[model samples]
Target: MFKRLRRLRLSSNIRELIKETRLDIRDFIYPLFAISGNGIKNEIPSMPGVYQMSPDVIVEECEQLKTLGIYHILLFGIPSHKDSCGSEALSDTGIVPKTIRAIKAKHPDITITADLCFCEYTDHGHCGIIDTKLKTVDNDATLEILAQQAVVLCSSGANIIAPSTMMDGMVWMIRNQLDKAGFSHIPIMSYSTKFSSAYYGPFREVAQSSPSFGDRKSYQEDPANRKEAILESLNDEAEGADILMVKPALAYLDIVRDIRERTLLPLAVYNVSGEYAMLKAAQTAGIIDYESVMIETMLSFKRAGADIIISYHAKEVAKYLLDRK
Candidate 1:
C-alpha cells in the first residue's frame, strides 16, 4: 500500500497549494550598471537584455521596474577615470553616489543597494589597493577604504551597502564605520562566499573589471572547497553582516543550502551574467523554451534555500509574472 503523492499533482490548484517553494518578484534584487553620461542605454552584447545606462537612463529604468512591482536594485558604477588607488570611488561626486541621489529623488520608494568594490574604478582592475611586494590585494588597506566608501554611499541615500570586494574583515570595518557615521540603521549585505569563477566573463565586459595582470583567485574563494565556503559565510555573519550571499548561484546551490542550514540571516544568491547569457543564447538558437526554463531555474534557487536572488533575468521574470496574472 503506497501513499498517493500523485493526488497532489493531479490538479494545478492542488500543485500550487502544496508547493514547497514559490517564486515572487519581491524575492529578486535587479542589478544595474550606472556609467557617466546622459541619454545612454547601451545593451550589453553578451547579456542581451541588460544595459549600461547613464544616471538619467538608470532613473528611467527604475521607473519601469517600479511599474513592474520590482522595487529593489543593486547598483554598480563605471567611472570614466581610472587610477591605481581607485580614488574616484571615495569621492562625494563619484558615479555611484550621484546615481544613488538621482534614483532616490525620482523613486524614493525604491530600495537601492550600492555595490562597494574597486575593480571597476582601478586602472589595473584589482579589487583593492595593491600590495606591490606580494603583487596581490592589500586586505587591511582595502578595509579602511571600504569603510569610507560605505559612508559615502550611505550618505548618498543608499538603503543598503553591499561590499563585494571579498577582502578579509570587510563587513566588520564597514559596519563599524557606518554605525560611527550615524548610519547604524543601514544594513550590510556581504558577498561572503564569492568564488573566482569563469562564469563572470560577461560581467567583465559590462563592468570593464578584468584584472590587468592576474586572476582574482588570490582573494576570491576557490570553487572546489566546500568547508571553506561554509566558513566564509559564517565568518561574515560573525562580523555583523545583516545578510549573506553565495555567488554564481546555479553552480553553488549546495553551498547556498549548506549556509542556509547554518545561519539565520537572510541568504542571497547571484544568478550571474554568464548564466543569464547562456540561457539567452539557447533561446535565440531555438534549443530551449526560454520562459519555462527561466521560471524553473528561478524556482531551483528558491528550492535550494535562497531567500533573495540577484539576477540579470529579474526584469524579464517580473514581466513573466505580470503576464501570468
Candidate 2:
C-alpha cells in the first residue's frame, strides 16, 4: 500500500506546520533611490510602484516603513552633478551621505545600508574611473575611491556599506579603510556575483546610470559561466566580506545555493528591477495573481538559502506577511 502523504496536504494548517521554508518581514531590505531635491517622488515608467525620492521624502518614507514593521533599507544616490572620477561619491556632503544622516536623525531605529558605487555619480555612467587607452574601468583607481566612499557613508550613520562595483580587491580595500577609520564594526555586503545581464534595463532609468559608451561586460560577470560566478563570490569571502550577494536573484537561484553551501557568511540576493517589473507587468495584463506570485517569488529566495533579500517588492511582502498574522 502507498503511504498517504495526501493527509498532510489536505489541511492548510498541516501544510504550515510542516513547511520547511518560510518568509519573514525581517528578511527584506527595501531599496530606495535618493535624488537631490525636496518633494520629489517621481515614479519610474518601467517600474510601476518604485520612485526616485528626495532626502526629505525618504525620511517620511522611513516613517511609513516603520509602521509596516520594515526597518532596513538599501540607499542609492543620484547626484545632481557628475565628473569623470565621480568625485561626488567621496564628498562628505554628497546626496547619499546627507540622506543617511537625515534618516538616522528622525528614525533612529532604522538600519541604513548605503550602496557604494559610482555609476550614478559619474558622467560616463561607468562604475569608476576609466582607462583612456583600454576604454574600460581602471580597477585599482576605482578601489581607492570606493574605500573613501565607504568611510564617508559610515561616518554619516550608515550601518552597512554595500559595494556593487564588481571591482577586484574592492572588499579588502574598503574593509581596511573602514577599520583604520575606526568603523571596524561596520559590515561590508559585496555584490559578489553580479552578472552583466539584460535584467538591469529598468534600473538604469531609476538610477540615471546608463553607460554613455560601451556596456559593463568587461567587469560584470558573464551569465553563462557558472564556475566564474562561484569563484567571484568565494574570492570576496576570502577578502573579508561580511556578506556575499547574488544579483538578479531569480535567474541565479542555483548560484545563491552554491555560494550558500561554500561560505559561512550571511548570503543576500538582489531581486533586481527587471524581475520586479516583469511580475508587475504580468499582473497588469491580468495574467496572474500578483500577491500570490510575489509571495512565491520571495519564498523561492528564502528556500534557496538567502539570508537577506534586497528587493523593490520588500514593502509589499512585508505588508502581506503582516496581514497573514
TM-score of each: 0.98, 0.98
The digit string of per-residue lDDT tens for model 1 on 1-325 reads: 1357667346987777778988899999999999998999989999898999999999999999999989999999999999999999999899999999999999999999999999999999999999999999999999999899999999999999999999999999999999999999999999999999999999999999999999899999999999999999999999999999999999999999999999999999999999999999999999999999999999999999999999989988999999989
Q: Clashes in model 1: which pairs? A: none
Candidate 2 vs. true structure, TM-score? 0.98
Clashing pairs for predicted structure model 2, backbone only: none
The local distance difference test score of model 1 is: 0.95
For all candidates in order, the CA lDDT equals: 0.95, 0.95
Number of backbone-clashing residue pairs for each candidate, in the order shown: 0, 0
Candidate 2: lDDT over CA atoms? 0.95
